[model samples]
Target: MTIIETAKMNGVDPLAYLADVLDRNHDHNISRLDELLPWIGHPLP
Candidate 1:
């Protein structure tokens, strides 16, 4: 499924999800990467 569809299925607003991921990607910890997945349904720590 497409990112928009996946994000929605996971209860995230598509645009906001993309924006947060893009914004946090550079500095986010690689070990905790799973936390960034759409299914997590929470903001970055």
Candidate 2:
């Protein structure tokens, strides 16, 4: 829910952002998880 709201606020596609983050979560650095935020994600057009 928050993800959707935040993504909307940032003009991002929530589904794409969530998918990308989930795919990358394993290899992503825990300390930098903030970089993977939905609002900061690069969505496919």
Candidate 3:
């Protein structure tokens, strides 16, 4: 499960997190998935 807790703990709004990641994460590799994680913000390199 994607930890909604991470979103909360990072002070990121859950809806915003979902929208952001979903909108841009289509091409992301599984090993680099942390880039889209709630705590990481905006698909970091």
Candidate 4:
């Protein structure tokens, strides 16, 4: 019933599962930005 148990039962990679969960709830949508920025780049002011 726990997250690890469920993920394991479904044969999902733990890291990938965590990433997908985080990505689903990501606050920013940089993909829509006009300019592609490096992952460490600060947002325009």
Best by TM-score: 1
Q: Which has the higher lDDT value, candidate number 2 or candidate number 4?
A: 2
Sort order, TM-score high to low? 1, 2, 3, 4
For each candidate, give its TM-score against the true structure. 0.80, 0.77, 0.64, 0.46
Worst 10 residues of 2 by lDDT: 36-45
lDDT of 3 by residue, 1-45 (tens): 356677888888877787877877787788987688776666422
RMSD of candidate 3 to the truth, in angstroms, is 3.6
Prediction RMSDs, each to the true structure: 2.5, 2.1, 3.6, 11.3
Q: What is the lDDT of every predicted structure here? A: 0.86, 0.77, 0.73, 0.47
Candidate 1 residue-wise lDDT, 1-45, digit = tens:
598899999788889998999999899999998988899876733
Candidate 3 residue spans exceeding 4 A from truth: 43-45
Better of 2 and 4 by TM-score: 2
- Ranked by TM-score, the better of candidates 2 and 3 is 2
Q: Which tens-of-lDDT digit does each residue in 1-45 have in candidate 4?
A: 475566666566555665655554456566754222223222321
Give the number of the best model, judged by lDDT: 1
* Per-prediction backbone clash count: 0, 0, 0, 0
Candidate 2 displacement at residue 3 in angstroms = 0.8
Give the better candidate number (3 or 4) by lDDT.
3
Candidate 2 per-residue C-alpha lDDT over 1-45 given as tens digits, one digit per residue, 9 for 90 to 100: 987889878888778777777888899889988888765555443
